[model samples]
Target: MQRNPISRRAEAIHPSAVAEMLAMGRKMEAEGIKVYRLVQGEPDFDVPENIREAAKRALDEGYTHYTPNQGMPILREAVADKLERVNRIKAKPESEIIITNGGTLGLYLAVMATVDPGDEVIVLAPYFGPYANMVSLAGGILVEIPMVKSGSHYSPDLDRLSEAVSPRTKVIMINTPSNPSGSVMTRAELLAIGEMACRHDLYIIADEVYERMVFDGHEHVSIASLSEEIKERTITVNSFSKTYAMTGMRLGYNVANPSITKAMSKIYQVSARCAAASTQIAGIEALRGPQTEVERMISRYAERRLMAYKRLSRIKGLHCCMPEGTFYYWLDMTSFGMNSWEIAKYILSEAHVLVTPGSYFGGAGDGFVRLSFATSEENLLAGIDALGDALSRLQPTSGRS
Candidate 1:
């Protein structure tokens, strides 16, 4: 019998839907077709001037070599300070935090460090697309608990979540100011989850990369800061990509207890060794630098959010709640009688606009689509205008009103 070359593990994972859509947009652009891309979650701004200057200074000062497998001590101190001041999570720079190649790597490391084969991981459905893949890569079964929708926001059903916990459960993965959905978990919700984790002796992987992108007076709470017992079991992952417009920098970190940090560092030392030395230097400045630029960027996003929401809500057969946080609007597209993939492809072909199919996130995302407002106001308006035109031609199969 001939053996297949690819491992089952490798074949089980789906290709990134965001990357595929981005590639399609690029291909269309190359063919002289204009494509208005709203598929990715990337901020379209440049790295803050101060942080860029810090990187250039590091290069001039001859800081090119890898400092340590864990990361530079100065950078860790800055991260610790930020955590304490902003997140209210008192993490020790010396033993609790380990810088990784990026937030994606930080999440992967946390899963690998804690989950064993056959262990079950509970995740909120319609989560960040990568969470499913990461759990699968760790040889864990992903058990999704769908968030209940109320008005325009999605929230965890605490009773359902509590019922889903089992003896085989090992980790509960959460993302806030969630990707795709843009629901920032409230403090009451965080406290309940933290208490639940303590009761079940489960590890909590909190992805707070979008912590700073909240809007409409919604607060971003770090679950680990709720209590000492909760903090002990939580491995909080964050990155510079979303917060500081440093996506290309590939810098992020994880804060966990000493034991979990040690396990993650062991994997990091062999795989990535360390993030770029200069990137680490820049991250220090991002944490400690003046906040005027950050404030300006977020303020701009708020204005774009309002503009996009007003435009999107006016379209026929579409329903969207104002996003509470993050830069995305999770749209209910079921009224058009098309699945997410069909809707996305139709928009791409007819309107020359790119959107992420909601089904890419999970089974719960089947009839929805996500639109990002991370680009300029002109692009945002133009893309939505084209989208509105495309959507107007469709006849509704279901009555949403």
Candidate 2:
């Protein structure tokens, strides 16, 4: 039998490790084995009651029809107000915002709208794995700039990042409260990156999906809010998934200047059409509703973060830095002799704990692994203990022991 040729674009992409491991863990659960899922960055909290009820109200009000390609006008207005009040970024609802199916798709639209064939997109290394695929889909080249690790912190190296930029560089993408590594870019770090983008005349694609998940006195600052010039050149993407535990809702949006938003709307209309109508209503409530639910969730995540980071750091052969934001622990396993992929598989099979191998993120991620703490306290304690035991039995790298 002959198989048809698939597109080179499709061939360039690989299945995401997070989704793949989540599936495998679920399969193990189906088989009656207790598998602790630590690979995916899904929040375990339930959606806030006000937001949930808003969706039901939308349905009851017969809001089931298709929404505007840009988004429901009301939601766009709500988002605009929230951006000004919360993020301190001014955006006109009519021309500067486009609602997306999710933050992931919003990133795709940003790339699709701005990236031309052979254009270079600079993504910070050890990034969320899907950014490469998103850039590839736009017929663009991906240029990775690995963040420099300084003791317990992961910080962007502006000089090196600027050096990586060339005439071919069209855009620079960054994530705050970053996925996989859980690093939150400081205001100083962001200003440096923003300066680089300005110097290079490159567009800025900012992903702040984990904006509300910051911990340990770290503040989440949207780069677009730094200045009017950068704001004009920036496209800010955010989601309700991580913040509100509304992953299934698929409600997210992007903010940019009018021309870019128009370009994104054209592609968005052809692809997603619009975020679910009811979901948009829910998003409106998420922005406008009371903050008690969000505050409660944040308090709980803070407790989990402290526990997970402390336990993971205590492992004999593993070294993990405390994440500034998000619920992921980035564990360095270079001493274990095995690369991230091999070690991840060993941990899953031996410890029954699922994790995302760092190499799946980038070459810089080769000896690292990412584990999510978005689970119960009991699971976090049990899973990290199992991981410690598994690592202790593995032989050290040559010359180490």
Candidate 3:
């Protein structure tokens, strides 16, 4: 039998670095290594009880059939209401929202609906890895604009961003409470970006999966809420995975203009049919039911963030900025005279701690490594202690002298 050739798109996509690290950690754990995993960006908590109950009730009621391509009307309306309540933006439920399998799928669908062949999509580095690969898959050029790092907070350079936009530029992808860095874009930054998007006639794909996970009195600003024009041009993507600890539920939705939503729904209908019915029901409950669970989870993550930051700061030659949001702490390893990949591998081998290499995000990430504080406090403290011991051995001469 002859093996079929893989498509170019399939060939273009690289296996996720986070997945690779997690797999390695699992192998080591299987072999009796006590691995402290800080790689994947998943919440350790269970799905909120109210959301789970909604899914259970749906199952018991036999609501297991396929729903509309755009999602259930109730879920869509609830999502729109959420946007209004949380972000202060008015969205039409029927024509402006498309439920997706996850925030990842929402991003892909947004790109597919907006990008033409050879069109340029501007992304800020260090971005989520899949953004570049997805652009390639959709036949769009991925134009990267590096973010300026000020300690731990990352701000998009508006001048550089303006330079990256040309007539061919179709979309700009923005991820706030960003993965790997946990940097939340300020309102002023969002306003600047919104102005650029309006001036350039470009669409903004705002990835707000970590909206509810902010810290230290920082606010998550939606670029779409900056103005009417920005709202018309922005596609805001959010998910239940991050906020509700419903990663396996595969439920998310996109808010955009009616035309864009229609186009995305067309792609969704052809490619995925619809998001899972039970998941959609769960999502509706997630939005409409009590939000106390989300607040509780955020509170716990905030505590973990503080614990991790304090521990990481004490390590010699390593610099960590207090993350304003999310469960990730980006550590600068430039002083270690090692690249992120080398540092990551060393930590795994010597300290039995798993982390994501920053280079996997982009070239700008070379001197950095990402640690997720999604585990229990005990594990977090233990992992930091192990890391401290490893770093001490590596830098003992300085103290000895």
Candidate 4:
């Protein structure tokens, strides 16, 4: 018998469902079928021209070398400034920030630095799919506290959250303006979670990548900004990917106290060293450049949001609430009497639309699917119409819709 060489840690981590769906869509397109892609978390917009120009100038200036492990000094200063102005969090550019290759790496570093073997990390259910795998890789146990869903909105329950905390709990991971669900954490919710963290003496890992895309007059709150004590316990990670359409540029940063920043830097130095020098220069421009393009993009997303809400409303068996933030609609497909993967597979085959299976997010998402409106208006109209048509053929077992 041949011996297996895969490490248990590597085996435990699953491939990202978003990536898997995108790959399947491409394979179908290769075989001559039109695949409507609504599965990825990436924005379909191009990088702003000014930011692109900055990168080009950096390359010409011979910035193709390794930067300090923390990142370029100018970019760090910009991030510090932005955190103060936009996020209301004060971070020292010199000691409290570290530039990461991307938001994903920044999140991984936070988990690696804080979680010890057997330490428990609490997270909200129906979370970003990668969070579980990150905790697994860090040898930390993941404890989920499901959010309370009322009609079209989701909120955290303070009583339930308090019940979930254990003596072994070391961290609470949070995402505001969340992906897939498009629910932005309210200021009141952040205050409650911050208070809980302070009481339990837990580290808070906050992901605020979708900060700029909030809508419906919803405010995005940085959990660290709730109080001075909360700020000391929080590790806030953000990226230029969604805001500036710089996903491919791979630039992100984290803000924490000097002690936590040092621990994350130890892993970052050996693993990634630093983000690309040219990319870091581009990030400086993204933060300091015009707000016109960013605002325009948000306006476009608002238009698409209305379109998606109207279309989803007309579908008989699917129930979805209008997203308050981000570019996704989380649809409850339980009426179809199918699991999330089954619903996703059926839609892909019948309507040629690729959507993310909600079960991939967590067990609480088993009967749902996430549809993204980050593509062109033409795609949104055609894809949702096709999805409604496909779902209409089935006789739903439940009357929830």
Candidate 5:
């Protein structure tokens, strides 16, 4: 069989697991089968009234033209102000920041600006699935460091991480209130990581997209906020998606040293041109406008996290850990002696519930599954009930219990 040659970078990537599962779930729904899908991290909430109204008003005033290649000055100023007030990151809007289409593009820009072919990017494992693809697409080697479990909580094996660094290591990419594991790195842990990166002369890509999606007793401290030295080496990316339920708005930004920011902006000018003008205005309202709606959304997610934890804990032989932040539950299905994708398949076939296989995150997650609590309470309850019932009927191959 003959086929067209594809670039090695593109050929190395796999289709997104979440997107694939969602498509399958939708197909089932079209066939009149009710599938309780907990596979996505997408917020099922409405965009706040103010943000929507702001976008509409911008359109009314004829804001359809392309914004500056870097970004609309007004929005960048607002973002810089919000970072100062909220994240404690002080950067000049003109030289240190550039607006992006979303966190996806923001991450890509950061990786492209610094990484070169054969350079290494250290990724904390059980990471968001796309991190691998992004690094590969940027022609960099992806290094994986799996977290150690400490009494249901996950923490980085700092010694192991330090051992992974090499002369080729260029970046240490991280996500707090992480996507698949939902483990929020403590302040002390973050400090230690910062020190390690400094000693290794590695750049930091801090993915703080879920900064506001935290639970009680869990605080999100941006690593770049630690010190001037660390801040200088860090590229911090964030978006209006999860916090404001404005995923469709396609507004995200990154702040870094002017050198890196300039490189990213040059790429943007040749690629996306600029973020949509009206969306940038909506982003302004998202940051500077009222935050009560943000608080309400966080409160709701906290409640849903509790509901999922309680239900998952009840399943026999299935170890469930409560997430401190984010809306995911990383379930340990290793007792059944099956890989994550196999377990996911079993549950979908027998239980009619959909979840992301942890292996999608990384090889370290082979025996785990990630379920989202980002759905409605009604759907959540049903999915949890089904999951519990299905797992209870199976016994661990190890026969330890």
Candidate 6:
């Protein structure tokens, strides 16, 4: 008898590069290898006590029923208020916010709501890996525009971006305090992007999961905050996972115009229905409660960022940019004349350090690797030392400066 075949969509997707590295690490651990895990993006911190208490209280009060398709009204309002206060953008609580399982879901839903088959979605290169896959799953084509590197900063090449736009362009996805590179777009960049979206009538999906994780005195400017016209065309995606260290809770929301939010709500209703009731309550407390914990976490990340940059810079042939935000350091390894996968495998096998290969993000990410600093300071330092040792082995004759 013939076996059932998987859908084209499922077959077309490749295994996640981060997940592959994680599995490799786990396999090494099973063999008693001391693996220094710097691949995954999960924060090592615990959820704040206040938010945990809120979830516990909600459970105690039996608030486990299904909520509105959009989300709990109170949590929706809180999210809207957060936009107004933190992002300086106004959104209607009842119509503009829809909470999903996490920011990943929000991104998928936004794509589903806006993109059609063969539609073009421009994504910045060295972006989060899943963005391209998500676009493909949504039946859209991803157009990558590489960001130009200036010393440590990554800025959009507006000229190239302009050339990429066309009548078929439906969306432009952006991540601030970007995932792999940790580069934040400036206000001027945001304005230029907004103007392009407006000119092309393209929707903008702004993933700001690291909005609160900036370092070195760099500020995050939301594209939606640029103007009301831009806000209408932009869907701002965020999550409690990064900000509140509640990754497992899987609670996230999107802010957009009422029409777009309504469409996303329909998709949510048909698929997820609503996020966890208790988690939504937890999210409310996270947004409304004391923000000291968030501030403390940011400070710790900043310190780790500095430590990683200092140590990684000491590597013989590897060049890393000082990230302005997020907990990752993107390293250019082209000088070693090896692709990301080769370098990643070399490090994993020779040094027992697992990192994400940049090729997983897109074509332009071929010669880079991304290391996460979301672990303890001690572990980060140890991983950097291991990486340096591995680089020496790769280029034994290249003397260190």
Residue 7, model 5, lDDT? 85
| Candidate no. 6 TM-score | 0.98
Better model by TM-score, 2 or 4? 4
> Which digits, one per residue and each the tens of the lDDT, describe model 5 over residues 98-142?
999999999999999999999999999889899899899888999
Q: Candidate 6: misplaced stretches above 4 Å?
A: 396-401
TM-score for candidate 1: 0.98
Error of 1 at 138 (Å): 0.9
Off by over 4 Å in 1: 1-4
Q: Estimate each model's TM-score.
A: 0.98, 0.97, 0.97, 0.98, 0.97, 0.98
Cα lDDT listed for each candidate: 0.92, 0.90, 0.89, 0.92, 0.90, 0.91
lDDT of 4 by residue, 1-401 (tens): 76877899999998988888888888899999998888887788899999999999999999999999999889899999999999999999999999998999999999999999899999888788899999999999999888888766688878988998999999999988887778888888899999999999999999999999999899999998889999999999999999998999999999999999999999998899899999999999999999788898889989999998998999998989988899899999999999998999899999999999998888889989999988999998899999999999987889877
Between candidates 3 and 5, name the one with more favorable lDDT.
Answer: 5
lDDT of 2 by residue, 209-241 (tens): 999988878899999999988998999999889
Better candidate number, 2 or 4, judged by lDDT: 4
Residue 19 alpha-carbon offset, candidate 4, angstroms: 1.9
Poorly placed runs, candidate 3 (over 4 Å) = 395-401
Provide the lDDT at 19 for model 1: 89
Q: What's the C-alpha lDDT at position 13 in model 5?
A: 94
Task: List clashing residue pairs in candidate 1.
Answer: none
Q: List the pairs of residues colliding in candidate 6.
A: none
Give all candidate RMSDs, comma-separated.
1.4, 1.5, 2.1, 1.1, 1.5, 1.5
Q: Model 1, residue 377: what's the lDDT? A: 90
lDDT of 1 by residue, 96-122 (tens): 999987999999999999999899999
Candidate 6 residue 361 C-alpha distance from true site, Å: 1.3
